[model samples]
Structures are given as C-alpha cells and as structure tokens.
Target: MSLRTRLTLLFTAIVSILLALFCGLLYGVAEQYRLREFHARLQAEATTAGHLLLGQERISLNLYKLMDRNQLTVLPDEELIIYNAQNRLVYESGTDYLALTPETLTRIRNEGKVVWREATREIVGILFTDQQRPYIIVASAVDTYGVRTVASLAQLLGIGWCVMTGLMLIAGRFFAGRMLKPISQINQRIDTITATSLSSRLPEGSQGDELTQLARRFNRMLNRLEEAFKLQRSFVSHASHELRTPLTAITGQLEVSLLAEDEPDELRATLRSVLDDVRGLNRMTNGLLELAKASMDASAVPMGPVQLDALLTQIQAKIQQLQPDYTIHLRIDPPDTHASDWQLTGSEALLRTAFFNLLDNGGKFSPDHTVWMQLIRQGTELQVTIHNTGVPIAPDQLPTIFSPFLRGRNANGHTGHGLGLALTERIIQLHQGQIRVDSSAEAGTTFTVSLPG
Candidate 1:
C-alpha cells in the first residue's frame, strides 16, 4: 500500500485501540459506582423502615398505604414478601412470587442485611429487628431507573466515539497528504527530467526540510551527469578527428604507391611514411584505450608501495636516452631516515607512463631550454614538480589543459594526440593523488604532482 494509506491505517488502528481501552476502563468504573450507589440507597431505605417499626408504628399498614399512594402495583414478574417476628409469613404482595431458597434464607438470617441477585431482577431483600423480633422485607421491580441511566450513558459514549473516530480519520488523511505533498512533487519533477533536459531542477519549496535537501542533492547529481556526458562527447569527437588524420595520411601514401610505375625508391619512401603514420596511430589508440580502461576500472589495478626517488631516476634516464639534445636536471632531496621509503601506492606502469608524458611534454615544448625535475618530501606526501620554459597558456584554457585531446593554443603546431596530460591526470587520480599546473607568461609552466608517501 501507499505510504499515505499505511499511515492512515496505522493512525486509525492506534486511536481505535486507545479508545477501546478508555471505554472499557470507564465502563468498569461506572458500573462499580452505580452498584455502590444502589446498595447505599437500599441500606438507607431498610434502616428507615426498621426504625419506624421499632417505634411501635404500623409497619404493614404503612407499607400498604405507601404502595397505594404511589400507585405502585406488584408486577407479575416481580416479588414482595414480609415476615413477622416468629419468621412466619405476615404479608404477601405479588401474584407470581417464588419462595426464597433455603440457602438464601440462611444467608439473610446470618448476615442480617440486604441481598440481591440477577435472577431476581431489581429485587432487594432486607432483614430488620423490631423490639428484638426479626423480620424480612422483599421488594422487586424491573430496575427501570438503572437501566435508563446505563443505556443513556452507553448511547452518549457510542456517539462520542463515532464522532471522534470520524474526526481523527479526516485529520489523519489531511496531515498525511500535506506531509507527503513535497515528495510527490519531487517525484513528478524527477520524472520530467530526461537526459535532454538534465539542466532542469526541482522547484524548491518554501520550507527548508528534508525534501528540499533531497532536491538539492538530486540537482547536484544531475550536474555531475551533465558534465560526464559532455566529457564523453568531447572524447568521441577528438578520437574521430585524431584517427581520421592518420588514416587519411596512410590512405594517401598507399594510393601513390599503387599509382606509381616501378619507382622503387619513391615507393619505399612512401611506404616508410605510411608505416610511421601507422605507428603513430597505433600509439594514440593504445593511449586512449589505457585512459578509458583506467577511468572505468581503477580498483581492478591495485597499487603497491613504489619508491619515488627510484621511479624518478629511472624516468630521468629514459628521458635522456629519448631526447639527448634537451638538457634535463634532476633535484632530489636527501632521504630522511624517519621517512617510510618515500614510497607511494600505485600501478608502476601507469605511474611510469605519467612521468614519461610529463618529461616528453617538457622536452617537446622547450627544446632550447633546460627542464627542471624536482622530488621533495613534505610531511607524509611526495611532491614531483616538472618545470619547462614553454609557450605560455591562456588563463581561461588552463583549467581544461588536462582534459582529453585538449591542446593549448601555444603548442607551436606540434603533432600530438593530446591524450598525454589527460592520461597523466587519470593515473594520478587513481592513486588518490592530485596534479596541478602553475604557469606564467615569463616564468614558463610548472606541473606539480602530490602523492601520499
């Protein structure tokens, strides 16, 4: 069932149980009070009649006169009896009277008090002494007065319960609907927000409640989704452009080879060019695949403790071999004995790839300038900073420099697939590290990588 219906049912059931318990308690107390009142009145009447008989009053004549004056008649279903001092029946008052059972008589004689039973309806029997003589008086009726009082009370209580139950049900429904209205609105808004309309947001409510918080959180989620979608679109577009360029070059070279007539030298040169283009294409595709895989499954590629100084030394040696013309400087701080090996947790291959990419970018952009590589330990973190005197990047483009296939305007017409920094950033992120660029028009650019040591 819906939440509102369940809430209503729950409320109704709780109220019903409480009301039933209350009514039961009230009935019990009221029944006790009524019985006490009836007993007290019977005792008073018995005492008054006994006093008059002991004062030499005509007790039988007085009772008969009272009955006549009050127009009281002995009902066929009622009983009236009187006994004298000798325990002999002195007067009888009803047509269908049944004699008291021996057990009842014995009880009355021993108790010397009034007694009654359900079988006798409203009958009350009293024992009295007149001049040291014992007598019994019995009276019976339908108990119309008690019956009317109990019936009225029950009727009033029943009506009050009905009215209260109806009011509670109505109030319950209203409150449930009011409380759930925000959720319903949020659901509707969410339903209307498709991929095409991801920019849309739920209308904020006036109350600063949990529903409002939920809407805000949902909007933030949508914002992230929109950003991811945009990145995916850019990646696809850049991939297409990068792939088509090399394929076109290879196709052109192949066409020339097919059209040429026995010029082996020219054909060989064209085929070599084609092979170079194929190799470049292959490298770009592999880089893109690595980046995509790392983005999707970083957890699958577990990281272990990697020595930072050793890794950097290795990268510097490799860079020297690859680009002998460029000067590369390595600055490593003295290892601290207290330090835990200056090691970080990461996939060795990916970390090496990121290092190589940074070195290559430095070498490619600053062929005439010295590149500075620094490794320093600060607290529990390792910092790797690469500074190169390359062309200045615009402030606006700085934020997106590490994005996939994004090349700065000052790349100097260099041939690159632009996945280098993107892959570097991905690898750093996988290691729970951060990479940032600080650049100036005259000071060149510095890329700093911070990793947990």
Candidate 2:
C-alpha cells in the first residue's frame, strides 16, 4: 500500500481496538445494573407475601387464593412459591414455572436470600420470618424485555463501531495528505529542474519541521552545483581563446613563408617567429595541465609530509640555478621548535609547483629582482609568506587576479599565463590549507600560505 493508505489504516486500527473494549465494558455494566434491579424487586415481593401469610388467623384456601392473586403480584412474569417451617409447600402464586427442591430450600434457609439463573429465567429465593415462624419464598422471572433491550444496544454499538471506523479512516487520509502536500510540490518543482535550469528552487514552508530543513539543504546543494557549472564554463571559454591565439600566429607565419618561396634570412626569421609562438603554446598547455592536476585528490598526486624550512632552501637553490644574479632573503621567526612540528601532509610535487608559481610571480614583478620569504609557526599551523617589493596591485583587480587568464592591470608587461595563483589556490584547498594575499603601496604585495603542521 501507499504511505498515505498505511498511515490511515494504522490510525483506524488503534481506534477500533479501543472502541471494542469500551463497547464490551458498557455492555457489562448495563447487564449488571439490570440484574441488580431485578433481584431488588424480588426481595420486595417476598416481604409483602410473608406479611399476608402470617397476618391471618387461619391458613385457609381463600387466604391462599387472596395472597396469590393480590399479595404476590410484583414485576411481570414473576412466579412465587411459599413453604412453611416444616419445608412443605403452603402457597403458590403466579405461574408455576420453577419448582422448589429440598436442596434449594436448604440453601435459601441457610443463606436467607439467594439469586441464580435457569435457562432464560432469573431466580431469587428469600427467607421471611414472622413471630419466630420461618417461611421460604422462591421467585423467578424471565427478563425478556431487558434481554431484548440489551440485544438492541449490542446491535447499535456494532453499527456505531463500523461507522466511526470508516469516518476515522477518511479523516486520517485527508490529514495525512494535508501534512505531506509540501513534499508533492517539491517533487514537482525538482522534476522541472535540469542542468540548464538549476536556478529553480523548492518551495519552503514557514514551519521549522523536517520538510523545511530538507528544502533548505536541497537549495544549498543546487547553489553549489550552479557555481561549479559556471566556473567550468568560464574555464573552457578562456582556454579556447588562449589556445587559439598561438595556433593562429604560428599558422599565419608558416603560410606567409610558404607563399614567399623564402629568401634564406627571411625564411629563418619566419621560422624563429613560429618557434616563439610554439614555445608560448607549449607553456600555456603545460599551465592548463598543472591547473587540472591541482584540483585532483591526494592519492592521485602521491602525498607525503613536506618539511617547510628544507623545502624553502631547496626552492632558493633552484631559483639560483635559473637566475644566479637574483637574490631573495629568507627569515624564520622564533626558530626554537621541534622538527616534526614543521611538517605538512601533501604531495611534494604539487606543493613545490605552488611555491614556484609564487616565487616566479614575486621575481617577475619585483623591480630590483628581490623578494622576502618568511617561515613562521603559530600554534599547530605553519605559515609561509612571500613579500615582494613590486608595484602594488590595484584594489579592485586583486579579487579577480586569481581567476584563470585574469591578470592585474599592473601585469600589462608580464610574460606569463595568469594560471599561477589560481592553480596555487586549488592545490592549497585540496590539502585543506588556506592562501591569502595583501597588497598596498607601503607593503608592496604579500602572499601568505597557512597549512596544518
């Protein structure tokens, strides 16, 4: 069954069991009340018959007839039998439906009063004493009318149970639908959303129930997916333009040379121009590859612990090999610390690529070809700062410079694809680290990387 049907059925079943018990209890109480009232009427009739038998001067047949017709009349269908102290039948009244036996008489004498049932009839036996003479009065009557009344009540109760159960089932289904209406609306809205229509959202109710929380979480997930799609589209568009420019240059240069039949010197210069375009193309392609790798998992990149001070020394040595005349000053704050505390968990190659990009940017931008590299420990985190005495980046351009192919206005004459800082950010994010940049006229530009030690 559907969830709505199941919920309705469950509620109906619970109410059904409770109503059944209530009906049984009501019937029992009603039956007990009717039986008690019947016994009381019998006792009253016995008292009246005892007075009639003893008040006479002589026990005659007319006296018996007078008592039978007038004295013993009480409730409908009532039968009366009177026995003397010797246990002999003295007078009888009403119908002789029940006969008194010796055993029955003995019990009534001992108990004074007794009540019992025979088939469909109720019997009450009472002992009456007047002037020390004892008499036994046995009375019986069929509660036919009372029985019919109880049966009618039972039939009414059965009908009421069925009617109420059906009503409860209908009410349960209606309320369950009202409660889950939001979920149906959400499902419909979600069905209409596709990759191109991620802007659509589920409607949320004001109530802070589970459904509200679910809508909020789904909206958050949609926001993330939309952002990722936009970023991917931007990267692909920029990459296409960047790749096309170099290929166009190389193709044009080769076409002109082929048409000129080429003087050796002119052909050599055309080849040189084409060679330069090919090298730039190679560099841009390699930068794009590095950017892709930075976004990958640590397992794909082969991770290990990298020591900070040692890594910095190695970068300095490598930069010296490329630019022997360049100089960078290195500093460490409060140097007394454990060696293990300086270690970071990550891919050595990826970390080295990120550091190289920062250093290259620092040197390329610095007027004096000099930069400052600082290593510092703060609690359980290690920080590396590269401060270059370069022209400060414009405040507005600082935000977008880390985006792919987006160079600062100050980078007008720079010879590099703008993928460096963006790649560095992706690598740091992959390792659960943070990178931030501060730039000003007084401070020049500073790039700080913070990683867990």
* Cα RMSD, each candidate: 5.2, 5.4
For 1-453, candidate 1 gives per-residue lDDT tens digits of 999989987897799779967877787787677766665655554455445544476556567546634554323244456676556776554454456665666567777765675663655677877777888766554555665687788777788888888888889988999989988998998899987888888877667888888888888889899899889989999899999999998998788678768577887888888999999999998999889866866678977878778888898888888778877888887745444557778888889999889988887888485689998887878899999988877899999999999988878588788899999999999888899998887899999999888
Q: For each candidate, what TM-score against the reference?
A: 0.75, 0.73
Residue lDDT tens for model 2, 1-453: 877788888888998899989998998988898889877877777777677666555466576666556644446677778889899887777477887789999999999899999898898888888788888988777877788888898899999999988899899999988877898899899999999998998887789899999999999999999989998899999999889998998998888887788789988888888998899999999999999988777667777888878888898889978987668788877677677777888878888889888987898899988989999988888899999989999999887878998889879888777899999999888888899999999989999999888
Off by over 4 Å in 2: 1-154, 263-268, 297-304
Off by over 4 Å in 1: 32-151, 326-328, 331-334, 339-341, 377-380
Candidate 1 global lDDT: 0.79
